[model samples]
Target: MTGAPAMTDSLLAVWHAYRLPILVAVSIFFVTLRVYTQSQSRPKTAASSSVPVSPRGQSPEKSQKLDAPAEKPIAPQNPTTKEIFKPAPKSVKPASGPKRVQGKKKPAKTIGGRRPSNEDNDNGPPVSFIQPIVFFASLTTTTERYANAFFPPQLHDISYIDFDDFFTTVPPSSSPDTRYVYCILIPTYNIDTVLSTFLGHLDETHNDFRIDTAPLANLAGYSVFGFGDKEEWPTEEQGFCSQAKEVDRWMAKLTGRKRVYPLGMGDVKSDAENALKDWTEGLLDIFGDILEYGGLGEGVRGSGDAMESDEEDVEDEDESQSGKKKSSTMVDLEDIKMNGDSAAPLPVDFTTVGKAVTVTETAKEMVPKTSPTYTALTKQGYSIVGSHSGVKICRWTKSALRGRGSCYKYSFYGIKSHLCMEATPSLSCSNKCIFCWRHGTNPVGTTWRWKVDEPELIFNGVKEGHYKKIKMLRGVPGVRAERFAEAMRIRHCALSLVGEPIFYPHINRFLEMLHNERISSFLVCNAQHPDQLEALYRVTQLYVSIDASNRESLRKIDRPLHRDFWERFQRCMDILREKRSYQRTVFRLTLVNGFNVDDEVQGYANLVEKALPGLVEIKGVTFCGTSTSAGAGLTMKNVPFYEEVAAFCVALNAELERRGLHYGIAAEHAHSCCILIASDRFKVNGKWHTRIDYQRFFELLEREKADGTPFIPEDYMMETEEWAYFGKGGFNPDDERWFRKNAKPRPTHLIPAEAQAQVDAHVQAQDS
Candidate 1:
C-alpha cells in the first residue's frame, strides 16, 4: 500500500505538468478526423468541383501546379443547354441594356447592329430584326384625331394594320431572324365596341387550350397606350382604359412575359398629352435597348410584378426599386418612329369634324364589327348588313301583318305595308336633324370615305336580313300566315330607314338591283347632296325631305355639316324641278311645330312652286324621343296634331292656289297625320291618279335600262281609291283600324273652319 501511493503521486505530478498540452493535442486530432470524414461525405456540385481558373479564363496549369488530391474530384455533370438559357425568374427585369436608351447615343433597332447577349436568339448575330408595328382603333374620330397629331410619319406609314392581321393568329416574322414588337394604341368604351372584339380575340388566343400557352413567344415584345374619358370612367378600377390593362396582361402571357415597357393610360379630357409624352420617352428608352440588346433584355431591368393601377402600371426590377420605378404613361401621340416626318397614322378612312383629312388607299369599314354603333343599332331592332346598310321591320309592317291598318302609303300609293322592306344602303348622313330619332348612333360625315359594299352584296344581305327578321315574328299572336309568306317576297322597299341613301356610292346599282327583282324602291333624300340628287337613278317614287322653308329654319331643323348647306338645299330644289318630268319626284314636308310650321305657309308654297313636283306629301313630325333630339330642343309638343296637319295642308293648298300652282288636296291619311296634294295633271276626270301601277313601273324601268326608253312620272299613274280622297280617314277597309293605347286628346283650335266637321267625325269615330 505504501509503494502504490508513491507511484500514484509521481503519475499525478507528471499529469499536472502536461495535462494542458495533452488536452489540446487530443482536441486537434478529433477535429481534423471529423472534418476529413464530413468532407468526403458531402455532395459535390459542379460549382464546388469546377476547375479553378484565372480571371482571364486561362487554365491554372499555365501559372501554378495543381497537385492531385488523395480522392479523385467528382466529375461535375455537364449542364444541358436549356438550363443555361432557361427563362429568367418572373421577378427579374432586363439584366442587360442599350446603355443608350435616350435615342441619342444609340441607333434604332432596325437601323443597325446591336450588342450580343450571353446567347444568340433568332434575332441575334450582332444585328436585330425588331419591327415595331403601331395599331389603333377609333369610333368618334377622337382616337384618330389624337393619333394624327401624335404619331410620327414613318411609324404611321408602316402602322395601321388591320386588327385581324395579328389579333387572331400571330404573323410569322419576315425571316427566321426577325421579330416584331406590337405598339398598340387603344380606346376604352363601355359599350361593346371593336376594341371589345379585339379583347375577346386576345382572350380566345390565350385561353384556347389547343394552341400553345405562349404561342406568340417569338415576338420580341409588346406595349399598349390607352385613351379613356376621365369625366365618365374617372379611374381604371372604374373601367378607364380597362381594355389596355387587359391587353397588357394577355400580351405578356402571349409573348412569354415580353413586355417592352409598361401599360400606359391617358385621360382624354385631362392629362393625355403629358401622360403620353412621358410614356413615349420611356418607350424610346426601350426602343434603344432593343436596338442594342436585340431583345427586351434577358434577366430583368426596370420590371416589376405585372400589375394594374388606377392611372397606369409601374414596373421595377425588384421590391427594393418599386417606389423608384416610373409609372406607366399614356400612348399614341409620342410613340411615332423617329424617321423625321410626323404624318398621321391611317387606321381607317375617317376624319374628325375639323381635322385635316388624308384619304387612305383602301376604303375602311365605316361601321366595323367592333363599333359601339353596331351594338346600338342591333339592339334597336335593326340588322346591320355588310359594312353600312341596315334593315329593320317598321311598326306599320307588323301592324299590317296583324290585319291592322297599313301605313299611309298603302292608302294613297297602294303598297302592301307588310310587303315593304325597310332598308338603307348607307348608315351615314350629313345632318343631325332635330326631328330625327336615330339617337346619334349613325355616323355623320360630310363626305363618303367608307368602304362601298357592292350593290349585289347589299341587295342580297338586306333581303336576307329582312326575311330573317320577318320570320322571327312567325310565332307572334296575330301574325297572318299568308301575309307573312307574302312579306318574304319583298314587293316594296322603303329606302328611308335612318340613313342618307344617296350617301352610298353605288346607289344606282342598289336601285337597279331592286328593280331587277321586281321590287319597287321608294327612296327619300335629305336634300343636302345636290350632286347625288342630280345623279340619282330612276326610282318608283323619289321624295325630297323639305324639312324647313328658309335657310335659318333649315339650319335649326337639319343641323347640316357642310358650310354651304343652304346652297346645297337650294340646288336640290332645282334638281328636283328637273327630275319632276321623268322621275316621280315628291316634296315630302315634315311640319315640326314651334320650329318650322308656324307662318311658313308661303315659304313652303315657294318651294313647291320652285320644284314643281308631281306631288306634295305633307306629314306631321313623328316624335323620336332620344337624347340627340332633346339636345336640339325637340319635344312631344313639337309634333303637330292631325287636325293641325290637315289645317296646315289646307293653308298650303290655298297658298299654292294663290301662287297659281295647279295643285290641290288629293288624298288624306289622318292615322299617320299625312296628306297628299296632287298636281292638275293627276286630277283625271275629277279623281286623283295618285297610286302607282307596280308592274307597269317596273316594266318602264326595265325598258329605260335596256334601250334608253324615255318615260314620264304619269306613264304609270293609277287612279286613287275613293276612300283615300279628301275628308276620308284614309283607313283601308280591308284592314282593321286601331289607335295607340293611352293616347292623349289634342286641341282642335289649329283646325280650319271647313275641316272642323271632318275633325268632329274623326273624333266621334275615335270615341266610339
Candidate 2:
C-alpha cells in the first residue's frame, strides 16, 4: 500500500506537468473536427457552388475545379466563330411584383452540378441583365433642377423617388452591381442627421445585402455632387457647410478614393446645366467602359467594322426627329443591313428633351424668380436696365395702367405708378432674408465682387429696359394708352428693385444721373453698412428696410452675413437721425405674422424716436413658393392680414404716445395690408403732407447747384391738406372722382409762396 501511494504521487506530478500541453492539443483537435464537420454539412447554394464556368471564359482546368463532378466544359462547335452580343429581353414584371433590380439573380437550379443549359437562357450568359438607377434628392427643387442634368433618358432610364417614399418603394432586398449604380442627393445642411436616420432604418430592417454590407459604404459606389450657395455652406476651411464636408469625408473613406464635386449654387440656367455635365463626367470616370456603346451588351465580341456597324446602327436610330418616341427593342444587324442605304435614316434632333416619365412636373414648372446675372434676370421677368442694373414692372404699375388701382407708394408718397421705374443698380445683396421673394440662389456679398458698370451705361440700360417693358403693354386689353405712354416717360426711379441699391459702387453717381434726367430717385438701403449710408447724397426719398426691432430678431429675420451687422445697423440709424434735417428718411418695417410682430412696440418706438423718420411704412410679409432653409419655414398663415398690420401699427402709435413722440398713424392701405405712420414734421398747420412735391424739390436742386449753395430740405418744403382715408378724397385710382380731385400737377404746384419768385427767376435763367 505504501509503494502504491508513492507511485500515485509520481503519476500526479507527471500529469500536472503535461496538463497544459494536453489541453492545447485537445482544443486544436476539436476545432479541426468542428471545421471539417461544418465544411461537409454546409449547403451548396447556386451562388457559391454548382454553377459551371464556361470554357470560353475560363480554362478547362478551372472549369473542372468549379464543377468537380461535371463533364468536361463544353467547347464551341465552331472554333472560328465569335460570340454575338444579344440584347436582353425587355423587363416584363407586372406593376405589383418586385421590381427588376440590378445585379439581382434569377432563381435557377443546377443540372447535375452544371449551370442551366445554354438553351434554358436563350443561349445567353448567366448574368443579371437589368440595371436600375435611382436618385434620392434632398429637396423637391434639387431633384427638379438636376433631373435632366444627368442620365438623360436617351442614355439611361433613371427614376426619381421622393425622400418620404423612397424606402417604401425600394426594399432592402433590391440588389446592386457594377452595371447598376444609385444616387442619393442630399442637402449639405443637416446631412449628418439625415444619413444617421437612413442608416438606422436599414439596420432596423437587418438589411445586410448592400455592398460592403455597411450603409455608408454602399453609397461609395454612387457618384455624388453637391450644389449650394457659398454663404449657405459658409465654412471657411472647406468652402462648404461642415456637414457637407463630413459627408465628403465619409464618402472618401468608404470608397477609399473618389472625391465629391462641389458646384456653387448660382441663379442661372448655365449653373444647372453645367452641374449636370460635371455629374456626367464623374459618372463616366466611375463606370469606365460601361457608359460607352455596347458596354452593357452581353458577349459583345469582334473588332473593327463589326463594332463600327453597331455604333452606326445606334446613331442612325438616334437621328430620329425631336420628340419622336424610339423603340427600346434591339435592332438586329442583319435586319438593319437588309433595309439598305436607300431607306433614309430618321432626321436626328437632340434639342427637344422629354419630360420625366414618372414624377409630377409641378416642381419643375416653378422657375426660380431670382437670378445671378442680367440675362437670366431678364428671363425671370426683369428688364436688365443696364450693366448690373435691372427693372421690373411692378403689380401696382400694371394696376394703375389698367385704371384698377395704385401702389402704396402712390398713396403714401404720390409716386405715380405708371411713371415710376422700378430699377436697381445692383443685383446682389448683403442679407438673405427668409421673407424675400428672391430665390435663395441669388448672389450674396458684403461688398462688390464684380466690375462696376459706368453710371451712364446703367442709366441707358434702365431706360431701354423700362421702355421695352412698357412697349409690351401698349395694346394690352385693359391698359390705358395714355397711361402707357406716360409710363414710357419714366419720371421716377425706385432704386428698390431686388437688392440693396446702396451696395452699387456708383450709387451716388447713379442718383445724380437720375436727378439730372429730371427723374426723382427713391433709394432703399438695408442698413447693414453704415459707411454706404453716410456717403449718400440727394434722393427724393430714402428708405431703410428695418426688418427687425431687436438685435436677436434682426439676426433671425435678415440672416445677415456680417458678424457686426447689428452694430453697423445701429450706426446707420444714428446717421439717418443726423441727416433728418437734410434729407427725407423713411423706416420700412416688413412685419411677419409669426416673427418680429410681437413684443416689438417699445423696440419700434425706440428706433422711431432715435431716427425721427419722416414716415414709417409697416407692411406684412408676403409668403411665396418654398423655403430651402428649415429655420425659415413660412406658410400662408405666416402672412399677417391687413387688420393684424393695422393692430400692430396702433400698438406702435400707442407706444410713441406713451413716450410723447410726435409720430402718428397717418394712413392705411387695406389692399396692400400696410399702414403708414408719419412724423408731425410731415404736417403743416396740422395737415398731413404725405405727397412729395417733386417740382419744388427739383427746382431747389437746380438752384443749389447753380448757386453753389448747400441745399436744405426744409427750404423747398410745401404745406399739405390731409386727404380722406376712404371717402370722397380718399386715395383710390378705381374711383375716378377721388383720384381726379386729389391728383396734383406733376412736381411743384405746392411750392411755398415766398419761393415762387425765386423759382420763376431760376426757370427763366435755365430757359435762357
Candidate 3:
C-alpha cells in the first residue's frame, strides 16, 4: 500500500507536468474514434464506393478485375466468333457488338451436357427467328456455284474462314431472339482438299473432351448438301459426297440431333445445279417451320443418324443399346433379310425405310432413302427397287385397266399394255432430255460407279414393286376385273422408264432373269452409252431414243453429259448397225415441235441409213406442262399436233425411200399421236407384220440360251392387227376412246410458228 501511494504521487507529479499535452492527446483519440464509428454507421456515400461489388458467383477480387471498363472488344475485319463460352483467352472479353455478337452476359443453364434449345429455354428471352449461315467448300468451283445459289448470307469458301469460328462451340447469336442454323454445301474429293481440313476440324470439335459433346445444341437446326464427280466416284462408298456426309454426322452429334432436313447429294457433271436448288427450296420450307414452331418439325429431328445417310464406319448407340429398333414405317423388307432377321415384314409399305440396313449402312446407294432425288421420284409415283432400279405404273396401263384403250405399243407391237411392267434397272442417265417427264427430278451421271445390285434382287424387287403399285390402282374409279388379273402376271418388262436401262452394270443378267421367268424384255436406251449398247442382251424388242436428228439439235434437246456426246451417239448408231441382224432394233423418235420437228427429216433419214434399224417409231413429244419442262422453254405450244407428227413421219419415210432404204409405214396410233415404219423384212404378201409373237420371242430366247443357237428378230414375227394398219385410227377393238384431260375437240397442232422458224434459220445457218 505504501509503495502504491509513492508510485501514484510520482505519477501525479508527472501528470501535472504533462497534463495539458495529455488532455489534448486524449481528446484527439476520442474524436478520431467517433469519426470512424460515425462513418461506419452511416450509409455509403459516392466518395466511399471504392470497394468492389461481387457478381453472384464471383469473388470480390475477380469482380474487381472484371469491373475495369471492359476493353471494348477490338473486332477485326471478319471476327471469329465463340461468344457463348469463354474457351480461349481471346474469348475472355465480351464480343464487340450490341447485335448479340456476344451471348448474354450471364451464364446459360446446361441441360444434358448442352445449353437447352429455344424450345426448352422459356425462362430466357424467346427466340424470335432463325438465322441461316450457308457454309461451303469448293475445289473446282462447282460447289461454289451451288453455294451461291443457296439462300443469301453464305460464307462461301470455308477455306477463307476460320474453322474455329464454327466448329469450336455454339455460334454467337445475332440477337437474343435470333437462333443459328447451318446450311452447308460441300464437295467431296478423292484427294485431300480444304474440305478435308474442315472435316478434320469438325471431327476434332465433336471428339474434344474439353468441350461439351453437344456444345452446338443451342442451334435451331442444320442441314447439308454435297456435290461430287459422279463420273469419277459414283457412289458414297468410293467417296462421292463423302466429306459432306462426315460433316452431317459430326454436326448431328454436336447439335444434339438438330438436323432440320436430310442430307442431299448431286453430281457435279450432271444435275448439281437443279439438285442443289431443290435442296435449298426444301430447307427454306423447313426454316419457315423453325421460325413459326420454334423447333425442327416432328419426326424430322433426330433423323441425322448413321442409318439415315448411307453411312459407313458408324455404330448406332440407340439401336445397339436397345437391341431392337421399332419402326412403324420401315418399308425395305430387304433390310430384314440383309440383317438375317427371322421375322418377315408387311409385304408392300407406302413409306420408305426410316433407317438403313446393315449392308446398305456400309456403302452409298445411288439413291439413298434420305436423298432428295429419291423423295422426288417417289412423289412422281415411282416405286424404288433396291437402290437404283425403279418401277412405275404407266398411264397407258391405267387406260388399259379402265378399258379406255391400250398404249401405242399395243397398237404397233400387239403386246397388251395391262400385262407390261414399265421399269428400269438404273435410274441414273447420261442426259437430261428436255422432253423427259423425269428430267428435272431424276439423278443423272456419266458412269456406272455406284453399287451394283444383284440381278435376282432387282428382278424380284421390281416385280413385287410393280405388282404392289398395280394393286393400289384397284381402288381407283376404273373397273375391269379381267384386265386387272392379267396385270398381276407381268408378262412383259418394258425397260423404257426414266433412265437408260443399259446403264445398269448387270443389265444382261437382269434381262436373262426376265427371260427365264417368261417375261419378255423390251429395253430402250439413250444412245449415249455405246459400250453398253454393244454388250446388251437379246430382248423382245430394242429401241434407241432418237431425240434429235443432228448434233446441234441433240445437244439442245438431250443435253448429253459426255464430253464426246455426238461421237458416242454415232458409236451407238454403228453398234445398232451391228445389232440389227439379230436384235429387232427400233428408232424411237420423240419430235419436239420447236426443238427437233422443223427440217430434221433429212437428219433422221441419215441416221436411219446408218443404223438400218428394223423399225422406226415416230411419236410427238408429250409433257404435262410441268415446271421442269417449262424451264426448258416448253409450253402448251411446244407439244406438236398429231397431224404434224404424221406429216413429219411421212416426210421422214419419203426421205428414207429416196435413199433406197426398204422401210414402209406399217402402223399408226392416232389417239396417242404415234406412227411406225418397218423394214421390208416384215412385209410379206403385201401385208405388214410388225407385231411380235411374245411367246415365240421367249421360246427363241430360251433356245438361243440352251443350245448356243442364235435367232433373228424375224423368227418371232406376227401379223399386225387390221385396225393397227397405216390409215386406221389404231384404237383397240375391245376398248373405248380416251381423250386427254381438258383437251378441246380440235386438233392439237398448236406449235409456235415463230419458234420453229427461229430453229430452222439457226440450223440452216449452222449448216451453211
Comparison by lDDT, 1 against 2, better one: 1
Q: Which stretches of candidate 2 lie over 4 Å from their true place?
A: 1-376, 385-387, 626-631, 716-730, 733-768
Model 3 per-residue lDDT tens digits across residues 182-242: 7788777554234544665566566555566666766767889988778878778887888
lDDT of each: 0.68, 0.54, 0.68
Give RMSD (Å) of candidate 2 vs. truth: 29.4
Q: Which runs in model 3 stand beyond 4 Å of their true positions?
A: 1-363, 739-743, 747-768
Compared with the true structure, what per-residue lDDT tens digits does model 2 show for residues 154-236? Answer: 11111111121223123221222212233434344332122333333333222223323222222213344455555443543
lDDT per residue (tens digit) for residues 1-768 in model 1: 799999999999999887644643453344335433433543221111211111111111221232322222232233111111122111111112011111101211222354344144343343233445556666565655555445422222111122223543455333344445667778876553445445645655565555565566555567888898888787677988988877787777666566778788899887775576566556545644554455554344322122323122233234337566432323365676667686655432221212233456676787877767887688788899999899999999899999998989987899988999999999888776767777456776767667778988999999999999899889998889898888878899999998899989889989888988899999999988888888888889999999989986786577665657888889899999888888888889998877788789989998888989999999999887753344345677677778778878877887888888899888889888899988998878877899999999888877887899999878899999988877778999898777679977655575556656655554454346
Clashes of each: 11, 5, 0
Name the top TM-score candidate.
Answer: 1
Candidate 3: the clashing residue pairs are none
**True lDDT of residue 238, candidate 1:** 92
Better of 2 and 3 by lDDT: 3
Model 2, global lDDT: 0.54
